[model samples]
Target: MTRPRLLINFAITADGKTSTVRKDPAHFTSKADLHRLLEIRKRADAILVGRGTLEADEMSLTIPAEHEPAKQPLRCVVSRGGSFDPGHKIFRSKGGAVHLLATDPRPDYDPAVYEKSGATVHTGALPDFLHRLRTEYVVETLLCEGGGSLVRALADLDAIDEINLTFAGHTLFGGQDAPTITGALGEHLPRSLEFELVRFDPQDNGECFLTYERKR
Candidate 1:
């Protein structure tokens, strides 16, 4: 099977927190970290995010000019409810193509609606969805910039090929029930999965940028 190589990248606090108690997106990404992230995105053929992330962050999800790939990667969203904002800047960007994967049974949405706005929407099962990404879209490497639930799902399915985590030394200590980067793994990760620390640099804001990779 020609499965796409999945790469999960995100920054977390020292206590393994991805966001702050106030739930502000700015708290999660620092300026230095953002530059590093864009560099990573430039190497991928597609970037994936969950619906909740799209709605909550109102992400534009574009690669920076200095790091832009020859062809812009496909922007993908895993939307179980089709609740993402069509007006988000990612859909408005003329830089790349956008693809939304929803489970909603409504065929009422005209692809042209998003197409006109600079995006394309598709719906299907997770595995089949990935297959389409690999075959139909010719995506060989997929980068997942996540909201925890999506990361957990992909990890549970054992679909992930690598994980690149940048641990920031800050904490989003309290919230009603905010998400974490890696949540509730039913069992210990397989012994086959081993992480090697690739880089450790200090950010201007007094946070550390740590990178890890899955040992194959």
Candidate 2:
């Protein structure tokens, strides 16, 4: 419960699909929303994404020099299988630390695999994993740019302090297999978590940005 403040951000289609049924990177959100992402990124002490997001988006976790924080937030990723290509852009080009949170530490987990790629790998329970970011990395504010599963876990853990969602109004990626943020929360009655909407920006391009803060 003492983990750093977490913000979850994502973009979805009108049909509530974050991406196509193929699970590819989303390009449906407007450029202005992308700028909004960078603005949010500039304020965090660390940025986290699931390995799927990194692989699909081919993202570099740093911001422009003008927007970089004083210590530059670390580029973070969580991999259940602890496998990632050394050639990913975040490894080759991100401006600060590359930290990998591992869910499974097999005997064959070679430090060099993540190390040579510039990531300091971590393995532990989700809470302690996040606590390390706060204590060891000095990450006071962590931003999660999600792939649905990661968002679901954090939401299930009641770890998210805020949620930022963009509804890109022009398309629909409809598939019974695809779900939006907070994916599938197993068999249970609907869980009610209250959030106070803090901002709503609707653009002429049919993009709507909404921010919600968990009620304490």
Candidate 3:
């Protein structure tokens, strides 16, 4: 079970929703929170996200100058199918090497288009891909920024090591179909994994930042 040390970061509304039913970009947090995110990003060897999150956030996946990061983290995206848009912000931006993990490749999918755009595509199940990141890429710390289903998959695998959360109490996206950190409203995880809160920072702007480490 060798893999990178996994960390997940998310911002949730007062009602515990990550996004609206329409799955809009998560821009409701403050400038401070954005700074917080970049600060946290500075600690990772690589940053990962589901393809939907990468597109929805329009993320460049690069460490900005303000952060004065020692180095830009490798930008990684995972998609069930091999479909990826070469025009996405991550592809256009200058960052550490880009990697695409296609857990399920379709017969019609071609990896060349993505390879031409300067990405290395890997095909496998999630756990195997994660192992490759650890052994082949030397990724010691892997940070996962999410779209709920991806997070849910990691949860099912019990691969998450640390959880970072921003609780935005000022906003609420209330809808039965809205998604939470793990995903859609119903159904429990295969089993319970316990974590203990290790950090809690309450800001004046009605946002609270919390960190939890798995209680293994």
Off by over 4 Å in 3: none
Better of 1 and 2 by lDDT: 2
lDDT of 3 at 58: 90
When summed lDDT is taken over every stretch of 10 residues in candidate 3, the lowest stretch is 82-91
Top-TM-score structure, candidate number: 3
**Residue-wise C-alpha lDDT for candidate 2, range 9-40, written one tens digit per residue:** 99988988887767877787777998899889
Model 1 regions more than 4 Å off = 104-112, 116-118, 183-194, 201-205
What order do candidates take by lDDT, descending? 3, 2, 1
TM-score of each model, paired residue for residue: 0.83, 0.93, 0.98
Model 1 misses residue 216 by how many Å? Answer: 5.0
TM-score of 1: 0.83
Question: What's the C-alpha lDDT at position 183 in model 3?
Answer: 86
Better of 1 and 2 by TM-score: 2
lDDT by residue (69-98, candidate 1, tens digit) is 677788898877666666777776665578
Candidate of highest lDDT: 3
The TM-score that candidate 3 achieves is 0.98
